[model samples]
Target chain A: MSPQDNQSTSVAASTTPTASESASARKVSRTEVRGRVWKQLPLLLGLVVLWGVLWGQFSWLNILTGFLVAIAVTRVLYLPPADISGRLNLWYSLVFIAHFIADVTVASFTVAFQALNPRPIPTSSVIAVQLRTRSDFVMTLDAIAMSLVPGSIVVEVDRERAILYFHTFDTTTAAAVEAMRAKVLVVEARIVRAIGSKDDLARIYETEATR
Target chain B: MILDSILDILTGVFLLLGGFLSVAAGVGLIRFPDAIARLHATTKPQILGLAFILLAIALQERQVSTILLLIFLLIFQMITAPVSAHMIARAGYRGGIIAPRSLLVDELEQAIDAAPEFDDTERASE
Candidate 1:
């Protein structure tokens, strides 16, 4: 769903969009609904895997029951079908994962050191990064990755505009804020390359061309 | 025998690092000025610390079931921590617990003001 084009405008408005109800209330276009199971394959598989993991068993009995329970849960609770790009890039995915871990490691040390230092932090900033993709999955993953990278907390997301507002530490200057914004965009770019849809890739190109 | 000793030492190092990072988060929580800043302290190091400890656990046990559970735990933490962090930050900002003056830049406030739907940050400012 294009956050900017979302019909949730009539609902309560804030820097962040109100959480859509049960996720069921959100609109799903016909194009997004390729086929029932085809669209939901990932969700069902995730649930099954989650079930098996919870049980800590990979036995055949566990698989059968997990699949059954997954079907039941999906049937019982309506969730918005995630918009998947249907493309998987293993190399890019590995790159994202590796870099993400390294980021967490390095940034954690930096922030931890700052915390332990006697000197007080002067200021922080709330900066917005307009993401290239409006895909919910990509946006969610991007937000998660950025938040995990330390020094930044996702304060608000303007779902309608595909904008993410981050409250970050040590960004007292406009240039520092700009750097933070660029950092978030790079994270978004990494996500888009990993599993982003065709439209998302195209939008990234458009952004590059425009810049 | 030598590899076993090295692995044991590595596990010990991971555990020590994990503990140190967690302590750092605690120190950060006490030191940071406000809720948003404290959030960075609480979440950032805490997650990586947990990851380190979990890795230590996996290394020590080297059991399939143990490792799988750890993996699930890590995945869930990665997914959920950001969400809760976001919610806390959002509440702090909207409730105006996060002092407006402490912030060097607030692009969100302008956007909130620009929206046609709602009225007033007077309650927020107060």
Candidate 2:
């Protein structure tokens, strides 16, 4: 089935609405169907590459099989249709990747050092930060990035208020809480620049200016 | 032959560091005072350590097929580690496993105070 058809089906399945009702609500053309599939091509390719790696083979036959398996699994899994902004700032993405690598390296060392230290363990805190972007894509990315960074992990997301709750290490004071909050916003801003739509980026800048 | 030996040595070093980090994460899990702090031990170094081990395996193995598997392992670990941690932390919070003294700011609690559905639980906690 075309990706547009897949999207309609997934959307219908996601909400309480009936399949026929959703199908009739929106008319999707053949070109639009192709476009939607093209949009999901990255996810497909990533899955196929992952499958190939998992099989530990890079041969054309293995890759072809992986590609086919990727398609089948994704189709059967019933994932929500990807909602990527489609706009990418190459420079910002490169910077973001570099920053992420550095953060991971540094944060891991810091956490490891503290964990192994004989001194009293610094108190941890659960802090809430309001996010500017409302996109689930950005929010998920932000949470994933933060969680992997060693010092903090996302505990909850209040989707309606665009507020994210994080459990952070060594956040004993109000200043420390604010610092962690600022750090999260900085990371969010980088993600916004790297992949968010123009409106999202503009909102980030506006939020930053106001703060 | 010399270059191959050098690659093997580097891979071994990476594998050692990965093992050490994994051990450190275990230590943190035991040493941490609360559920959330323990989650840091379970998530961060564990995933990074696995990545290192996967990288070492990928480097030493010449088979394209096996390398693909190693890469997949690394990616999947990275993706799932955070998600699993998130689930556990949320469950811990909702279950009241969070040490009230450790929480610096309780915005969720404040929100729950205003929420009618949470009124009884909020009062009970107080």
Candidate 3:
């Protein structure tokens, strides 16, 4: 048999391994030693650059102390793991950067407009919006983006019902609220597609009505 | 004198951008639609913007230890911000502070119940 056939045969045979061996194999595949190194490279590079800059003034002992302190802080704070898959997509970061710039610019203008206007900006109201994206990360990003837009804030999120309550400085009608909601959803969809798994995205938008 | 002037200008620009981002995050915290969203506004920019400011300070001071401490602060903020946000959101959910129409799935409630019950109320109070 060819090497491929032989490998397949070995894999098939290994599948029926006794419990202990199976557990070991399971760990091997899931741990994926190569993937971890690749995934951690960016963070490690950042650390190295930071260390190099510090090494000029600090003794070895001080450097060690600094590292220990950083690690302790990291442990206490418990930063969530970056989406490994998302980081691989170069376009994801670009899109997020673009979105952030646009959001900040528009928000600045809106805030300025409100400040310049003497009146209470007509009316303010809270509107209920249904979210299409489900991933916590995507949802969080969406909310951050919307809230940064000067006149709106996310007051509540109902994960069970997939709804959000947004307070707006100028909610005139249902249609206007809906238009804003649609804009938020569109931005979220772009972000989700750029940075999340297709399966996660689908599950996020999944509803009896939308499905 | 020219070098000093350039350094001063660079420092000023970094500080300005950092302050702008921080303000944006504050606005977002007050304006977003829900607890989950507000968490993003409160956390992400706080880390990123603060990191930039710290970096600018380090550059201005040009001290190794100061730079290291600032880096430590950045890492700490990055790690803690999300956890704090998560805790606040969970509390908001339990308290019925969240709206009913925005969520489509909730895996957290099950996880929260199944996990060991510490006095969450006391935790929140603290």
Q: Best by DockQ, which number?
A: 1
The window of 10 residues in a row where model 2 chain A has the poorest summed lDDT is A6-15
* Candidates, ranked, DockQ: 1, 2, 3
lDDT score, candidate 2, position B36 = 84
Q: B55 in model 1: Cα distance from truth in Å?
A: 0.2
Task: Give one digit per residue, the lDDT tens place, for model 3 in A1-211.
Answer: 2322212211122123244543553365545646755665566555644664556554677567656655565446533334445433568658876876676556554554343445543344455667765465566666656655545555545544456555554545666666766767766766776776677567556742473
lDDT of each: 0.82, 0.79, 0.56
* RMSD to true structure for each model, in Å: 4.8, 5.6, 12.5
Interface RMSD values for the candidates, listed in order?
A: 5.4, 7.3, 13.9
Among the numbered candidates, top TM-score falls to 1
TM-score of the second chain, cand. 1: 0.90
lDDT of 2 at B50: 81
Ten-residue stretch with the least lDDT total in model 1 chain B: B117-126
**Stretches of model 2 off by over 4 angstroms after superposition:** A1-27, A54-68, B62-65, B117-126
What shift in Å separates residue B114 of candidate 2 from its native position after superposition? 3.4
